[model samples]
Each structure stands twice: as C-alpha cells, then as structure tokens.
Target: MCGIVGAIGSRNIVPVLTEGLKRLEYRGYDSCGVAVLKDGALQRARSTSRVAELQEQVQADGLGANLGIAHTRWATHGAPAVHNAHPHFSHGPGAEAPNTKPGHIALVHNGIIENHEELRAELQALGYLFLSQTDTEVIAHLVDHLYEGDLFAAVKAATLRLTGAYAIAVFCAHEPQRVVGARHGSPLVMGVGGVDAGERFLASDAMALAGVTDQIVYLEEGDVVDLQPGRHWIEQAQAGEGGAVAHVRISEAQRPVRTVTAHSGAVELGPYRHYMQKEIFEQPRAIADTLEGVEAITPTLFGTQAEQVFSQIDRVLILACGTSYYSGSTAKYWLESIAKIPCNVEIASEYRYRDSVPDARTLVVTISQSGETADTIAALKHARSLGMEHTLTICNVATSAMVRECKLAYVTRAGVEIGVASTKAFTTQLAGLFLLTLTLAKLRGHLNAEAEASYLKQLRHLPAALQAVLALEPQVVAWAEAFARKDNALFLGRGLHYPIGLEGALKLKEISYIHAEAYPAGELKHGPLALVTAEMPVVVVAPNDVLLEKLKSNMQEVKARGGELYVCADGDTHIHAEPGIHVIRMPEHYGALSPILHVVPLQLLAYHTACAKGTDVDKPRNLAKSVTVE
Candidate 1:
C-alpha cells in the first residue's frame, strides 16, 4: 500500500502536497517523491527517505508549480531505493533521438499492474525505452502512447488494458491545467476547497486532506475524475445496448458531495516517545468514547435495523484480518456462551478463496480499524453474493466503504491509530464487539433484567480496571529486560483468554522481529512442548477462571522442562514467585470480559521489549498501518 496526493490551483502547491504526504505517511514510508508541472515542463525530485526529507529535496531544488502529484511508496515489485521510488516518467519514442527532446508525462500509482511484463515487451518493440524496474512505469508509457490531445480520454483508454488493482494520478506537461485520477480497487477521495476560482484536491484517504477541505466525495470502483482549478467531475464505466463497453456516465452534481469533519488533533503525539506508546496509553479514553452513550442493553446500539436483523439470523459469522481477526475469534466464545448463538470466525483473505456452504440466515459481521481493508471488503461482498443479506460492521471510520456496504454498523470512536502494529484499535474493537454480543443476547431472550444490570455495571467500571492494569508497567519493564536477551518466546492461555495469547505473540513478532508463537495451554503436550527449553522464554496469560488449575498444570510442564516462566497472574490465583518463575500480578480478574484487560499488559510487554531491543517501534519494516491492497 502507498499514499498519494494531488493539487491543481493558482497557489504554490508544494506546502499543500508536503503536508498531505506527511499525514498519509502511515500508509507507507519506504520512499517518497513529488512531481510538478511548471513553466511548460515537468520537474521531479525523489528520495529513498521519509516525507520530511523529500520536502527538503524539493526546497533544495527550488521547485514550485500550480499543479502537482506526490507519492509515498511501499515497494512491491522492486527493492526500495531512489530508482524504484515513484513519480515515474514516460517519454514517447523518437523524442530521445539526436537534436530531439523527450516528451514529459509523470504518474504515481498505489497498486500493482499484473500485465506489465507483457506490455513492457510490446512497448520496447515500439522503440520506447524503460527506466526503473517498476510496474508503474508501464502505465505512464501506455497513457502517453494513447494521448490524442485529451488527457482524460487517454487515462481511461490506458486503464482498459490494465489488469489487477490500482489507484493512479497522472499529470501531463502538454496539459498543465488538469490532473486525472482513476481507481479500480484502491481507495481515492476528492476534496473541494474554497468557492469561486478556488482549489480542488485528491488523496488516497480523507485524513490527508483534513485541513485542506471539509467537503469530500469518495470514488467508486472503475470511476475516473479530472480536476481543474475550480471544478471537477466524476465518470463511471457502464455497459451499452449490445452488452459492449459504452460511454461513461459523467456526473457533476453537488448534492451527492458529503461533508466530513476532521479529527487532526487526535493524531498528535502528546508526551510520549513514539506513536505506539501514545496509542497504548490512549486505551482508557478510546474505550470510554466507544462505550459513551450505552445506558442499557439494547439492539439499537448497533443501528436501528440491528434488532430486526438479529431476530432473523440463526448464526453469527465474523470476517476480519490481522489483529481484528483475533478479536473476532474471542467474540465467538462470547456469542456462543452468552447469546446462545452458533458462531464461526474466518480469516478474510482465506475465506473467499475456499469452498464453503453458505446459510441464508447467517449474519456476517466485519471488523476493521480503517474500514478500507481490501480482503475484508471482498469477503463481505462474497458472503452477500451467496444470499446472506444480514450484514453488520464494527469499524472506526465513519465514511469508509465497509460502512456504506453493510446493512448495519457500530462505528467505534477510537479516534486515529497511526502505529503499524495496532494497540488501542484492538481493545476498542473488543469493546464494540462485546456490545454486539450483549445486543444479540437481549434480542434472543437470553439475558434477564438482573444479568443486564450486572453486565452494564461491569462495563462502566472497565476504565478504572484498565487504569489499575497500566500500573503494572514497571513490573512488565523488569520482565522485558530478561526477554530482550532471548531470541524465542512462547505464550499460553486457556478458555476465553486463549485468543489473547495469540494476540500477545503477534504483537511481539510484529514490532520486535522475534520468533514467537502461541498455543492453547491445554494443547502444549500435544506438539509445542517439544520446542520448550531453558533459552525459550514462556509467557502465560493466567487469569483467575475455572480453568486456572489446568493452566497451572501446563505452567508446571514448562518449569519441569527447565523453561523460564513469565506469568501475568491474577491477584487471587496464588501463583506467586518461585525458583525459575517470575509473576507480575494483575489488579483484578475481569470475568467474561477478561480479553480486553488481559491484552493491555501484553501490549505493554511487547512495546517495552521492542524498545530494549532498539528496534523501530512505530514504523516496523515491511508493515503498513492500512492494508488497502491484497
């Protein structure tokens, strides 16, 4: 995934593009570049550095233009370097000969072009030389080859030959007044600013255009747009009378344009060393915002139609990816036990590729923080195509494609999470998913008045309970010192807390680059016990539950194998410090909602462990905050 931004107006647009690229750096930060159309020519600058460094390069070169496109690239088809960076240029054949100048056309792309190899061979035969080993370079050549005095028509025609997914923004030296953009599978939003003779902008996400404009419109699939100084229009590919591709439908109506307020303040880092640390400490406020107005256990907390949909559905099917999938896996236990509903959790990327029997009465629930994950959206659509109509989403973005596609939604107020490895988003998702579980229980007549009041009171006290857990950071940091010297780690849990074990392992591996794995504590003797040794550190999420005795037996198995133990024990478990064992006591055991509290300490453990190892905690290598591409 990559980030893109464009601006076309009379003002110097370097500051605008630079600020937008800085905001969108969460998408990717391997390399960044910018291209501007000025003085009837194209000027370019690229760097294998952060956006801030790219801005310095632009200023050093003294580049300014009224219209330009910028990109922050995450390389896929080639290594990350200056040659593979974006703003790829294409010059038509015969222009690079003696006494001739090459044509100038620059483009920035976000996704992959599958047919680039075949097209590149064809273009080479036509005397078009290539530069850089990138799939994006082929698109610029194709667009330049098809240009016939109209930039918009050439872009649409070039896209007709493209396969796979992409969201591209192109600028032409021949036509300096326009910027053309198109999206097939990636996300793109157009922003309108000022009034008459004002400015128009485009970005991969609305957050990049926060202060630039409040009026934005999301582009649908196969939609293309051309932005001028004070005007823009959208067009979608449609079919003709004979089932052939016909003329696109161009729409310029202002009524469909939606106004969205930006939360730029939420993304600022306030007294923390990194964004990951700031986000880990933001869990209390984020959870409070997610559970703000819930005073009773009602189905309307999800949406108005949630009650109707819950009544008609017989089973729950959760679809998610990454950490969101682990939250969904934990919810399966809650839905089956408290709501008395059969539930199944599936990985979104693998769900659509397999053959499975679909039941029409099943409710499809999707979980995501950005709400723009490509695989999750595709899996939701695939489930709907199989005649499963009841759909719901627990998402953080209010205007994302998932919210627009689903029938019901519960938007979590987690604000903005910029860390590549999620912290607050995971806990806030559990907050929303727990609310969904309670709503289903009420709709299914499984909750009594007494039980409803008890659960609500417990949920209200979660903020204080989480605060107590955060006080154990010093203990966790002490454990982290021993962990930093180890190369492998094992995590264990049982019953409802098992998924928390999996999440704990994931967090450590994501940021620290350590070899970590998780297994159900009961399943240790089956296969994983063979790998335990004195050098391998074992972490246990030992909450006080009915399975505590069985979990303790497993902990003893690790100790019997001469393995060092690091236990996150509850206050009443009586699992005290002993030889070859270390215990960090939790304040209180949260029953039926223990995953939310248990995960916080694991987050702190991973953060401090990565810190001691001197790794990049915020921008982990080869990981992106938003997985907008498959």
Candidate 2:
C-alpha cells in the first residue's frame, strides 16, 4: 500500500503537497519524498523516516515549487532506503544528472510493476541509467524514453507498455504548469479547487485532499488524466485484439465530479493518546451513526434494488480480508441461525485463486473499511465472473471502489479511522451486517412483527450497551498490566464469540507486537493446550449464553494447565475469581448482540496493553491501514 498526491497551482505548492502526505500517512509508509519543478529544474527531498522528518529536510533546504508530485511508499519491490523512496526521476538521453539537477521526468507510483524485470533490461540496453532498485524507476525511465514533446502523451504511451497495477503521478521539468497521472487496477482521484482558486489536484484517496477541495473525480481503470492550473482532461484506454499494445486506442472520456465532504477535523487526535484509543472509545457513537434513522429493518435499507436482490438469493457468500474477514465470519453465524440462510465466508486474497461453486442465486457480500482494498475488489470481480452477480458491500467510505463495484451498499459512518489496527470500523461493519441479517430474516418470513420489533429495540439499545462496555476499560487496563509482562497470549471463545477471539488476538499482535493466537474453547486439547503454561496469558470471552457452561469447562482445562485466565464475563455467569483465574464482569448479557459488546473489552485490552508496552498504537509495523496492493 502507498499514497500519491500532486498539485498544479499558481502559488507555492510545497505546503499543500506535504500536508497531503501527512493526511495520507495513515495508509502506512516506510519512506516519503517530494519532487517539484523549481526554477526550471527538479528539486527533491526524501527521508527513510516519518513524513515529519521529510518535511524538516524540505524546510532546511528551502524546497518550494508551484507544481509537484509527492509519495509515501510502503516498500514492495525494494528495501526501505533513501534510494528506494519515491519521486524517482529520469534524465532521458542526456547523461545522468545530480539529484538537484534538471530532470526530464519525475514520477511517483503506488502499485507493483509485474513486468519490471524485462522492462528494466530493455531500458538498460537503450542506455538509460538506473538509480533505484524499484519497478517505479523503470516507469519514470520509460516515460522519459517516450517523451517527444507532450508529458501527457508520454505518460499514456508508457502506460501502454506497462503490465500490472499502478496509480502514478508524474511531472516534467519542461512542463512547469502540468502534471499527468494514470491508473490501472489501483485507485486514483482528481480534486478540483474551483476556477477562482487556480489549482487542480490528484491523489490516491480523496482524504488526502481534505479541506483543500471538496470536489472529486474517481478515475476508472485504464484512465489517464492531464492536470493543469484550473483545468483537467481524462482519456480512457481501450485494448485492441488480445489486449495488444499496437492497437490500443485512446478516446476522451467524461467522468462526473461529485462533491464529497472530507472529514478533515476527524483525523485530529482529540483527547485520546492515540488514534486507536480514540477509535475504541468512539464505538458507541459509530454504531449509533451507522444505525441512525432505522425504525425498522427492510431490504431497501441497503439499496433501492435490495428487495429484488434479497428475494432472489438462496444463500450468502461473504468476501473480505483482515478485520473485515473476521466481521464476515461473525455474520455467517447470524445469517445461518437467524435468517435461515446458508452462508459461507472466504478470505478475499485466497478466494479468487481457488476453485469454488458460484451460484447465481447466492448473494455476494463484501466488507471493507476502505472501499479501495485491492484483493477484495478483485475477488468481487472474480465472483461476478463466475456467475455470482448479486453483489453488496458494507464499507465505510461512500466513494470507495467496493461501493462502485457492488450493486448494493451499506455505508458505515465510522468517520475517518487513522489507526492501522481497526476499532470503530469493525464495530460499525458488524452493525451493518446485523441489519442485513434482520432484513433477510424478515424477507424470508422468519421474523414476525413482534420479532422485528424486539430486534429493532435491541438495535436501538446497542449504543448504550457499547457505552457500558467502554466503562470496563479501567478494569481491562488492570488486566493489561499483567499482560504487559508476557510475550504470548491465547484467546478462547465458543460459537459466535470465536471470531471475536480471533479479532482480539489480531489486535494484540498488530499493535503490541505480541505473538498471539486464538482458538475455540473446545479445541484446547486438540493441540493448543500443550503451549499453555504460567507464562501464557489466556483471554476468555465468556458471554452468558448456552456455551457458558462449556466455556467454563474449557477455563478449567486452562487452569489445570497452570495457565492464568483473564475473562470478560457477564455479571450473572457465576464464574468467580480464583487462583490463576481473573474475571472482569461485563455490564449486561446481550443475547443476539453479545458479540458486539464482547469485542469492545478485547479492543480496550489490546489498546492498554500496547500502551503499557510502549508500541506505536497508530501505525503498526509492516501493516497498512488500506491494503491497496495484493
């Protein structure tokens, strides 16, 4: 995953580009750089650290320009070093120039170039000198090789020669007022700052342009855009016979610009120590906003065609990855038990590569916080190719690629989640999925009027329930104190809570750098019990359901292994504290909505544990908030 931001304006654009990089930092990056056309030459600054360090380097060197491209790279083809940082340049047929010298082309790229080996060899044979071990550098050299006159034409021709996903922003020293960009299999969007403002912008996500511009144009696959001061144009590329390069034709395309109110203020770390902590505490309001104005559950709540789509579906196929995959797993239990619909959840990255039965009548639901997840979008397309065309998405971003690809969508109002480890987004997705389950149950005549009324009341009370759960943070913090001293964690749950346990383990490992694993309580004797010792901390999600007795039996098994148990249990579970056993009583026992409540304490546990361990709670190592590249 990476981020790109470009601006062509009259005023000095250094601050705009750097601030855009700061906004996109949540996507995760190992290195950052900016290339700008200053005084008819390319001026660049790069750092193998945070964007703040890059900004310092820029200020110390007095780097400023009217037109520029910036990038935050999550290393894919190269190591996280200064040479591999983006804003790579090429000098064309001339001798290689110094870093501060005039350059023919400067480029920033987001996705992988799959055919770079061959391309690099060919460019090298043509006498182009390479500077960095990145596929992105090859693109910049290719653009320089093709540059006869126009930067836009050279970028278009370069895209025709490339094979793989990319969202690139390029600028030429000769064209001081222009920046060209193109995308294929990755996301790119244009921002309009109005005619009077005299600026046009490009970014991988609209959030990068927050507070600068509200208007956005989402570029489709194979679209190339030319951005100049106060003006822009888009061209769509159509493949010829067998998708050959010789016959590729370009035609002008009209992409509608929509006004999106970017939440700039939401990115601020208000009173919380970290974005993760703030997001965890915001779950109550997030769930409330996701469920607002829902007096009753109906098929149309998803979309206008949801009623027709729900009536035609016989089963459900959930596609997602990461935390979204866990949310989908939890929904499978709800859809099968409550709605009487057979449901199967698949990891998006693996689903497309494996053979599976794809029925046309099956409803395909995708879940993602950012709609731009590359694997999920590709999997959705793969399912559609196999005749599973009835598609729906539960995502946070309204303008994300997932929403555009799906026929129906339930947009979660989680605001902007800056933390790499998801908190509010996961809860909001569960809220949306539960609504879908209720709607399907009603459609199948499984939910009577009284049942619907009762479920609606429970849905309305979720905010208050989540609020009560957050009150247990102080208790969770106490448990975290004991957990901070350990290096390993084991989470145990039964039935629906099993996925919740998995999520808890994921949170702990992602932010705290602890090696954590989760298993169904009954699976302890199968293999995991052998790893249990006094050094291992066991977390049990013990809701007062039918599985409580069985879960208690599992807790006894852990106790017999000399393991310390940290349990989040209901007040009336009758499970009390004993030697090697610690219990944090939950506020109340929510029947169908128990998973939503149980997950909050686990999140708080991970948050406080990471805090005690002094790990980076927002940007976890080697993890990107949005997985844009597969």
Candidate 3:
C-alpha cells in the first residue's frame, strides 16, 4: 500500500502535498517522497521515514514548487530506504547519460507492475540505466521512453503498456504547469480545487483531497485525465488503436472538506497513545454509517444490471484475503442456514490458482475492506473470464478495483482504517455480508414471509443491538486480566458461533502475540483437548442461543483438564457457574443477528489483553494497513 498525490494549480505545492500525505499516510507510511517541476526541470526529494519527518526536512531546505507529485510508500518490491522510496527517477533500465535532463519527468506510483522484470530486461538490452531496485522504477522509464513532448499522452501510453494494478501521478519538464494522472485496477481520485484562478489536484484517495477539494471525481478503471491550467480533460484509457475518449469538465465548488469531530479516540494527546484506540471509540458511528444507505434497497437488491443474473444464480462463491476471508466464512453460515443456498468461501490467493466449477448462474461474492486485495481482484477477473456474470463485492473503499469490477457493490462505510491489524473494517464487513445474505435470501424467496419479516426486524434493530454489546467492555476488561500471565488460549463455539470463535482466536493471535486456537465445541475431543492445561486459557463463546448448552459443555471439558476457562456468556442461569472459570455477560439474544453483537466482546477482550501486555496495539511490528501491492 502507498499514498500518492499531485497538485498543479495551487500555492507552494510541497506544503499541500505534505498535508495531503498526512491524510493519505494511513494507506502507506513506509517511505515518503516528492517530485516537483521547477525552473524548467524536475527536482526530487524523498525520505525513508514518516511523512512528518520528511516534511520537516523539506521545510528546512526551503524547497518550493507550485506543481508536483508526492508519495508515501509501503515497501513491497524494495527495502525501506531513501533510494527505494517513491518519486523514483525513470532514467532507463541501464541508461548511460542520454536523458540526464534535470526535470524531464518525475512520477510516483501505487500498486504493482507485474510486467516490470520483462520491461526492465528489454530496457537494459536497449542500454537504459537503473538506480534503485523497485518495480516503480519501470513507470519512470516508461514515461521517459514514451515521451511525445505531451506529458498526458505519454503517461496514457505508458499506462496502456503496463499491466497490473497501478495508480500513478506524473509531471514533465515540458509541461511544468500540469500534473497528469491515471489508474488501472488501483484506487485514484481527482479533486477539483480553486487554485489562484487556475489548477487541478489528483490524489490516490479521497482523504488526500479532503481539505484541498470537496468536489472529487472517482476515476474509473481504464481512464486517464489530462491536467492543465484552469482546465482538464479525460481520455477513456484504451489499450489499442480502436478507442474513444470522453471529455468531461469539473468545477471547483464540489469537493468539500470533511469535518471530523473530536471523538474520544480520534486524537493522540496522551492517555490512549495509539490511533487504533481512537478508532475503536469511533466504531459505533462507523457501524451506523455502514448500514445507512444499505438499508434502502433500490428496485433490485443486487442492482438492475445484475438482477437477471441474481435471479438465475443457484449458488455463491465468496473469495477474499485475510480478514475479509474470515467475513466470508461467517457469511457462508448465514447464507447456507438462512438463505438455504450452497456457498463456498475460498481464500482469493488460493482460489485463483485452483480449478473450480463456476458459471453464469453461480454468483461470486468478493469481500475486501480496501477492495484492492491483489488476489481477490485476480480471482474476480478469473471468475468473470469464465462467464460468471453474477458477481458482487462487500467492500469498504468505494474507489477500489473490486467496486469497479463487480456487477454489484455493497460498500462498507468504515472510513480510513489506519491500523494494520484491522478493527472496525472487519466488523463493518460482517455487517455488509450479513445484509447481502438477507438480500440474497429475499431474492431467492427462500426467506419465507415470516422469516423475511423477522430478518428485517432484526436488521433494523442490529445497530442498537451492537450498542448493547459495547456496554460489556468493562466486563471484558476484567476478564482479560485472567489471561495476563498466559501465552496461549483456545476459543470455542458451535454452529454459527464457530466462525466467531475462529475470528476471536485470529484477533488474539494476530496482535496480542498469543497462540490461540478455535474449534467447534464438540471437536475439542477430536484433538485440541490435548493442548489445554491450567497455563492455557480457554475462551468459550456462550451466546444465549440454541447452542449455549453445547458451548457450556465444552467449557466443562476445558475445566476437567484443569484448563482455565473464560466464558463469554449471556445471563443464562442454566450456564453452570463453575469454579476456576470466569464469566463475562454478553448482550441479550438478537436471533441470527448475534454475530454482530458477539464480536464487540471479543474486540474488547483482545484490546485490553494487548494493553496488559504493553504491546504496540496499533502499528504492531511489520504490518501495513492496506495490502495495495501484491
């Protein structure tokens, strides 16, 4: 993942880029850099540190430029270093000294260049020189090699040749007044700004354009825009000779700045040191926003274009990466039990490599918070190639590739997840997936009138139901202390709780540095019981539902082995309040809507346990917020 921004029509651009980078930094913070066109040449400055540090250096040097492209990189192709940072120079694969012009062209890129090695080899054979070892260097050389004196056309041609996910911003010496930008399977946004009576702004995401411009246009895949003084034009990006360009002009009054309120966990003053804590407090609002537009279904739940496909689909295949894959696993239970549909949940990275049986009638549901997960996008493309016309995405980032590729999109309004561990994104995705399940069940007529009415009532009541769950935080904190001295744990659930159990274990293991395992309440005897000891804590999800009795029995199994039990239970007096076991009361029943409520306790447990360990809860050790690069 990387953050990219460009400005051509404003005051000193370095400052604007700096501010924009701060907002976009959540996308990438491994390294930062800027490419500014000045005095008929391109000048570059960069850093292998945070944007705050780099901005300090840029200010100290008194660097000033009106138009430029800047970047904050999350290293994927190269190590984190100054030379490996963004704003990479494009001399050639091995260029000697032919194009040593100071400001010929400068650019920054996000996403991967799958054909980089091949392009580098060809350029090396042509005697093009290289600097740092990064796939982004190919964009620089591609721009230089395709320069036709017009920066926009050259950038467009370069994009046409390149294959894979990329959103790039470019500037050229010949066209110092403009910043040309393009996107292909990667996120990009064009912000309309009022700049000294003339100019344009382009950034990788809306956050970069937040204060600069309120009116922003999300660039579609295969689209390139020509940034000019006081005006800009968009050429529908085409691969070959037979292509058409669509010209659309935008005014500056549209892009408005989002005024974020000073929430309890938003700012880093002192107490809760990390942003992840701040974001945790914002979860309630985020969850509400995710349900805002989704509640109002249009003429068709899956959209008009996909209506016919949706009506014909017999099964569903959900492909995703990481946390979203877990969300898909949870959805599989809902779809199979509630919607009565046969569904498959596959990790996108693995799905693409395996042969499978899917066709026009088999709907493919892809889930992603960023919607830019490399394998997920590839899997979507693979399914589309196989004539699977019915497709949808449960996603957070609306500008991501999955949103553009999928026939139907369910957008999760969990805005700007900075922490790499994924907190609100996962919970909100579950909400979206749940809604999708309801929609599909209704569409297939499997949810009978009585069942549909109950589902709707539950859906409408979920937001408040989630609030009830959040109220259990104090109890969760008390329970986390039980595991203060333990290093390994086990999570148990039955039926639908099985997925929640897995998710709980994943959250604990991912950031808490604990080894945790989850199993169906009955499956513990199959194998996992051997690992349980007094030193190992076993967490039993005791939601007061049909499976509560079964889960309680499993808790006894842990206790029989002298394993400490932390039972997350509801006020079910039937739960055998055994000795050497801790009970944290969960929210009351919400029928099938329990998953949403079940997660809040686990989140609190994970958060407080990590706090007790004095770990870096937000940044962790080596994780990036979005996996923008493959």
TM-score, every prediction: 0.97, 0.97, 0.87
Q: What local lDDT does model 1 show for residue 222?
A: 84
- lDDT tens digits, residue span 363-474, model 1: 9999999999989999999999999999999999999989988999999998888888999999999999998888888888898899999999988988888888988889
lDDT of 3 at 297: 33
Clashes by residue pair, model 1: none
Against the true structure, candidate 1 has what lDDT? 0.88
Assess candidate 3 and give its lDDT.
0.76
lDDT score at residue 524, model 3, on the 0-100 scale:
90
What C-alpha lDDT values do all the predictions have?
Answer: 0.88, 0.91, 0.76
Candidate 1: regions farther than 4 A off = 95-102, 194-197, 250-255
Best by lDDT: 2
CA shift of 512, model 3, Å: 2.9
lDDT of 3 by residue, 261-287 (tens): 211112343555566665565677888
Once superposed on the true structure, which residue ranges of model 2 sit more than 4 Å away at CA? 91-102, 194-197, 241-253
Query: What's model 1's lDDT at 46?
Result: 91
Of 2 and 3, the candidate ranking higher by TM-score: 2
